[model samples]
Target: MGQREIRACWFGAGVLVGAMAASLCAMRAMARARADVSADLSPEVSPEVSPAALPVEDAARAPSAAPESGADMFEYRGFVVHLFWQALAPARYKAWCDIWEAGAVVQEAGGPPATYPTAAEARMAGGAWARHWIQNNG
Candidate 1:
């Protein structure tokens, strides 16, 4: 190629590289701004009130100021379990043993939350479920 053509090719390559770099920088800045906004919006948990420090019974019985969004809490066999509907998959219910002493067990993703007509019946069923889970998985 002629000297002029070579120079034009190099200039084009440099411009392309510069554009790519500018795009990458812009994306990184946008990500950082999004993170900052999320941090500012989310509720901050107090250092004094760790989850382990809170009693399981109190957590189960306590009224949440937060709106009912398909999440439920239950006390079962001295442990508190939280059953909530996943945001992405609203049809499925996710269960978690909230208390540390319960080993913070997360139920299998597809497992359904135990259902009962009364709290007493729920407690009985929950105790059985806990025992079965511990024996098989723990």
Candidate 2:
């Protein structure tokens, strides 16, 4: 296979691994949350208590503020795109982007292996790649 194809294959594998890790983390978190809720239940408290029985503080709260604006971040087609770059060598950089909707990650788009001498270039590449992905997949 070509170098570009090989890079894409590796990057795709990385994304899959990352997605699995995130799912495992979410599962563990859900289990912990369930345990916490169960521990909060006392022998006197019925498992099927009505909402009216809940204290005023138990009511759902308001949503948080929106994300701040920046050069490497922007909203596109109802999705929040965040761009980031890492220095891989003295004159080489790598970039990736995460797309979010409803405050959760939708996907990660990794930039091509093109030489990026500056962080700005890397971020631009990543953002472009992410936008294209969104156009076809979003």
Q: Give candidate 2 misplaced runs (Cα > 4 Å).
A: 1-71, 113-115
Off by over 4 Å in 1: 44-138
lDDT per residue (tens digit) for residues 1-138 in model 2: 899999888877886897697567546645654565567565545446653666655422211121111136789999888776655564576777788887557895555667587766777788888888789888
What's the lDDT for residue 45 in model 2? 52
Residue 91, model 2: lDDT of: 53
- Residues 57-136, candidate 1, lDDT per residue (tens digit)? 43433333222123345655554554333222222223323322343334532232754443334444444565566456
Clashing pairs in 1: none
**lDDT for position 78 in model 1:** 52
In terms of lDDT, the poorest run of 10 residues in model 2 is 61-70
Against the true structure, whose lDDT is highest?
A: 2
TM-score of every prediction relative to native: 0.31, 0.45
